[model samples]
Target: MASEAAATGSTNTGILGWIERSGNKLPDPVFLFFWLIGILIVISVIASLAGWAVQHPTELTEAGEPVVIAATSLLAAENIQRLWVDMPTTFTHFHPLGYVLVVMLGAGVAERAGLFGTAMRAGVRNAPTALLTPIVVLVGMLGNLAADAAYVVLIPLAGIIFHAAGRHPIAGIAASFAGVSGGFSANLLPGQLDALLFGITEASVETVFGDWTANIAGNWYFIAAMTFVFLPVIWFVTDRMIEPRLGKWNAEAAGNAMAEEQGDRPLTDGERMGLRWAGLAVLFVIGLWLLFTFGPGTPLIDEEATPEARLTPFYRSLVAGFFLLFLLAGWAYGKAAGVINDHRDLVKMMAGAMEDLAYYLVLAFAAAHFVAMFAWSNLGLVLAVNGADFLSSSGLPAWALLAAIILVSGLLNLFVGSASAKWALLAPVLVPMLMLLGISPEMATAAYRVGDSATNIITPLMVYFPLILIFCQRWQKDFGLGSLAATMLPYSIGLMLVGLALTIGWVALDLPLGPGASVFQEIPGTVNPVAPAAAQ
Candidate 1:
């Protein structure tokens, strides 16, 4: 044991080793927020004492000039009092908190009822062996809708599937990991992440463009495009590059222990019935949404409003619509599968889901305070204005500017792993700064996501990185952090390049990102806003 431990320690000594060491030394994400809050307080005090201030770019005073914003010390008497008195409200009102909890409340039921697992099994089990790579990769990409469930269920199961098919198990693990982590941003439909990140974007936009609203589907078409673009990349890389390198499946040499441990079990009758019901339930919900959207009364569309204004109701209802879709489908599946016996069983499933989120609740509390404090200090605005000025003076093309944002965001992902946390920090500066540069808030958000997701597979800081390494180790006992990072490096580099190219092309084409979302935000009275294509 000691010799094995020593060898493992030796492997973590170079660049990957340094990253692992440094990342491990840092505090957990929850405590990292507290540390940031503390640092921000001290900085606020210093900046306030130094009389640091800035001229607001857009907001004007009664005198019809740019408004001056001054730093406010977080430790000031009134500010300190507000923090203690409003702690609960601040945490609860955090934008992403409610959005995540509500969606999970329903998704949790689906997962606990075994709907996700059985569904994934059915999909992968039926794939022709010749197309297993793309099937696994595509499922992994769509699995983001299940959030963490994809990592826990699909990835390990993939290894077993590959082994059963007489293919390399590590290659299966690699393909699944590439889809789950590397393709984190690629999905056919939006889910909790869309709500979470856009909620933050809304808050940041309100800081500068007060009337601007966040559309959850702002990056819809781009991300949907990503799902298709990344599929072939994963297929090619796994089949031609990764699998070829892994050689062949040697059940005897690999001990075949893991294969036995995780038998390839086909779906039972009850599971099939449950899946049928779940499918019908999904279609039923879709029918209802469409009926309301286009039917005579048209509750989801405002008849008296402009075409753009008509989408507001539809966009706002998606959160609730998703909730009902998952809830009804899970309930239907659970009933048929015998996983849920009664209403109490359904309640129990939802409660169990919230239990898993206990850590997130704590993290959200800390993060909320940090974000609110940053806003109160005016530090975010000052930095955004200054940053915007610097970028504008550089005379870089808009596409190049967005590409730089994606690159910087990708680099930052290696250090900070939480998408919401990182976006909360960057949005205040990046969103507003980009808006000042003629880029819409949605466009800035789309850029951030491309960069944020491209490097997840390569970063040890990502929460699931260790978990993915453990999954790989099940196939090759010697697989360490460095080994996993090296395996995923190609996907990371390739995906980042693809993401950058997509962003550049999307901007150059002047396409609408989603319903009522444009590539540029027109300054009122200064220029006419570009009309977006009507939402379908």
Candidate 2:
């Protein structure tokens, strides 16, 4: 039956099909932004012409009247001068651009040297059959710390591992995909994503409060909780709902059973040795960061500042810390595995990493300009202030507002899968608007992640969606894109329901999202919530 369907089915249909069609019709994210820039310019002109204006939510005039702001046309002489003159500066100063490139610089070497694959394999190699799904799900979630390596390595390994364990290979694939992409933001540790999203958030926050900086770890605790909460959700859906429907595995019926074996192969002695060295590299990098933070001199600390402010430098150093950790670990593994013959080989791998990011560099250019022009036009501010006013007046509680953010973010994920690109677009409005309502940018970011992660698996527009579909077809042959979406639907719905509940519960509890990060924030242009003041 699976083979027959595989032979007959031609294209995607239903909701997934519509999404694929719509998304396909849209320009590439790079071009999408180029088009959006044009649209924004038109809107700015119209708004400027119509005399659209709003009272500054927080700014005050010298006489204490609310400062009124009118939209500035992007075509204004000054604006046009700024655009052409500052083009290079705008792209170079794009917030997430450096953070991603730096982190990936190290990650790419580690990937090339085979460290990420070995680690992922070691994670599930010997799990008991009863424990396989949970372990795979957990690893998939944890694998996020390794970035995109999880997608390229673990999911296929899972299919092979499951087949070797006598279960349906597709079940393994679904479970892995569910945890990896669907649970993209659920991790105990902050990685490149934290840097990327927070960089964008800081840019948004700066428009309202220039002195503010985003702590990349702002959503750490929330995402940590997300991991545990989502683990069982993926586990249950895969084992009970998805697997039963997939039925028992019959290799004969399985089409193109993936010219596979990496998962089945035992770690070579060299691989094991390399793993040990990489583990030590991680310890060394972490210990070095610890020394910088807590050892004598404490260059990463500022003695004259308040406690939170003192740790600001330390928080900022994590980005570099991650780069070193990956670079050293990858180099160590490559040396042990004989993959990197020398320093020149290391340079080549690092260069390859940036080469892979060419698309992101292009996308970032469009996004940076959009963000800059949006700030220049005063349109984001106008929208944020008025939007906040409407929401605050609507009388919905804070949790409902956040829940709405989650749903909207989830909806948007269906059309735009680049997390950084979308966050760069949304954060300008979402962050400042929520800040007006006494919600922190941290809380808003958390909500966006919850929505974004839960919907990743079900969305055909997600860049990796086609890859996941192909993985399914390798096992079942009959799995069309819709079939892939259908199999993953239960996992998506389960994750969404659970994720939403958790967000509401977190807000209700007023749990601190991370160290020095809270569910509420002092509105911009107002008092800071020092620990002592917060206690009072």
Candidate 3:
């Protein structure tokens, strides 16, 4: 795909060309994990033989002294036995796997029932032409709540809507892709990703601070802010930068006959009815959750707990809450839209959703093993301790360290496309290391998300990259990988810069990242050593 892009146009030459070529040669992400596991094993053996060890910064002996941790050789007889015996347990216990699968069970039903598609169409169709760009961008940003449905549904619909409005369809594709994939982490509401990533973050935090709890909405406010920040970036880049460069839409020249033929169709009576009911269903779900949260003897709040603990259940219930919301709304829309005649159809929709996750299940198995091995080797802790020591000695401003993390993560993203897999690998080291530097786990996670999402659009390895290209080809057959990359490069760069700036400013201002989440941590009897230096 990358080579096809490079060969098709001059727009993808230079750095874009190099990235495509290099990224295309990388192994499939699933295989890549197996290779990483092998490398990790070899490295563990070498480190163990070489007597590599670190002082456990957080864990102390009974005498109140720091403990020493030594590298455990993966080649050890006992370790090899445990690996064989615990293989199934490791895969099953993988955090992201369960979180994603559970959420998708509900999301899949919503998507397959036509609720997501109808909702997006309704949103875009109702917007005045003048507000189309921002509306499309906003819907695309919020579409993350539906997981992959946004990429498949919104990108193509944006193209058709633009063509009907006599604008460049490719520009619509650019705008939608920018919001859907490029600004992936930006959403007003927490979704499956929040649960999945925070699950990993919680695991990493527990490695250093055993009592820390996971909050799915740890970065909620920041991501909400990101949605607004990125909305303008996509709108301006699509309107002023990309569309002008492509010139006006040429109906005859542009091979988008199919799009032009379809034009803009008014929603059917059934769809309209379905949407109304779905809206009511959404409100009903929200009301139920509130009742559980704030009503007398609220089930979502623990009366016997401290004020902070009272909200923990509420926060944790959001995952199941969203599940019910999607499930009920989808069922309501399905019934009203005439897509579901009975309970059997709903069951089928749920089953179909699981069918689509077959590949992810396979990938998760390999990823789970790699993560388990990394933890067992104690290499993540050793690396975190050493890395934290290096950073502490360097005396770099905390913001600079965070900026560097975002940059590195963006660069690595060009090669590794799975957000969960990448986070699983990095969090073990980065989370604890930052914690040692007085940065909160949530802060480390926020910085990682900024970098992780910024370069998604330009990377061919992203699961949806080929799908986006296919969407583009519907408009211009000659539009190859390079064209897609070129079209999205500006958004990638702009959003990355904006995201980096947001991270730096958010840290400097010491704003709460989310409900009860902060940018810095205070260890008992120790000053917050990695506090951000005052802005110049």
Candidate 4:
């Protein structure tokens, strides 16, 4: 293993091994949030005593001077009272909670109905040997729409497909894993993650710009572009760096990777019919949305609003749109596939989806309190002000500041695995601070996605890392955790660099992040603070 890792110019015995060890020592993410809240209370009390404050950017006095904003003690009578009284509201009103649950209600149906699985099989079923790597990577990226389907279905199947094609099974597994986990955030269309992250972004935005509501698809265009940027990187790493180092697979030596009956079968006639039905369902949903947008009422299109504001309604509707799209398509597919018999069965699938979110609900409870308390203490705003001031004074170019955010998110991803949990902790500080420094919430969220996705493959702490390792060991009994990490390291490093460059270039070009979403947000009270690229 050491020789193989050395040959590939990767390492798992030193800093990376230490990272894996230390990361495991951390508490459960749920308990970690609770601990953070306890720590936040202490910080709030001290900051209040020290008179930590900043001038409110929007709030002003009768004379038109900026109001001096100060930190409030979480232990104060009013704050403690609100905490106890508002506990229910705090948990219930956590924005990401509803967004995630609703999306999953529909998605779970799709995954169970076999739509996601069959779609993946169809995509890579007949790929030519020459284009197999890119095809696998692309399918892996698209398979992210199903969340678990990519990891559980497509990745292992890639190994079989490779073996049958007379290629190294591990290389196929590596490429698929890279595309699925390493390119976690890159997708052609906004899905559950978009709803979850942007919901949190909206919540974070309220602390700084109270009137600014985030569109669920706020980072749509940017993430779509990431799909292209990452596809090639995963392809390059898998073919050039990873495959060259992995010796040929020995079919005789490798144990059966899966049960004899478990190898991917050609889609059944019923499944193919289900797929056709699902396709029709998707088209119907898209057409319905188009009609709603362009028809006489133009409910989704605001005629009275500014050009940039016109599509806000359409963007917001995407949450519901995704729900209906997945629900109807899954139901259609299930009906044809004989997986669902009646409306009662449909209801069961939705319930099953909610059942899957049980852990997320617990995590959201801890995160909600942390976010709410951070806002109530006034520290969220104060930190943003102070951080923005320091960042501004540092004279780091705006593009560089955005790049720094990507690096911070990527580094933190090594220890914290849940995307929402990390973003919940980060968005409060990173989003508001960057917004105060004249970066858009869209841009900040986009940068976080890039960084968060790139490092997922190398980290052992990622929830799926062990599962992936198990998959690899099925083919090669000697495959260990370090071997898996070493296999993915090149993909991690390559994606990070490409994603960083993409982010920097996006900011430098001042491109729109999504519908009406720009790289810079103009604060009402001040000139745009983003420093020019050449000025750096």
CA displacement after TM-score superposition, residue 166 of candidate 4 (Å): 0.3
Quantify all predictions' global Cα lDDT against the true fold. 0.83, 0.85, 0.84, 0.86
Give the Å shift of residue 200 in candidate 3: 2.0
Q: Write the per-residue lDDT of candidate 2 for residues 1-536, one digit (tens) a residue.
A: 33333333336566766786787687788888888899999999987877777777667899987777778999999999999999999999877888888899998999889898899899998889999999999999989877778987899889988887889988999999999998999999888888899989988987765657778888999999999999999999999998899888897664333534334578898899999999999999989988998999999899999976898898778889889999999999999988999999999999999998888888899999999999899888778877887787799999999999889888888888888878887999999889988999999999999999988998777767777777777776667867888898999899989989999999999999987799997766532111111123
Best by TM-score: 4
Clashes (candidate 4):
0
TM-score of every prediction relative to native: 0.93, 0.94, 0.93, 0.94
Model 4 ranges with Cα > 4 A deviation = 1-13, 254-261, 527-536
**Candidate 1 per-residue lDDT over residues 82-130, each given as its tens digit:** 8999999988887778777888898999989988888877878778999
Off by over 4 Å in 1: 1-10, 254-257, 524-536
Q: Candidate 4 has what TM-score? A: 0.94
lDDT of 3 by residue, 415-531 (tens): 888888788778888998888888988999999999999999988778788778877887788778777888899999999999999999999999999987899987422212221
Candidate 2 whole-model C-alpha lDDT, 0 to 1: 0.85
Predicted structure 1, TM vs. truth: 0.93
Clashing pairs in 1: none
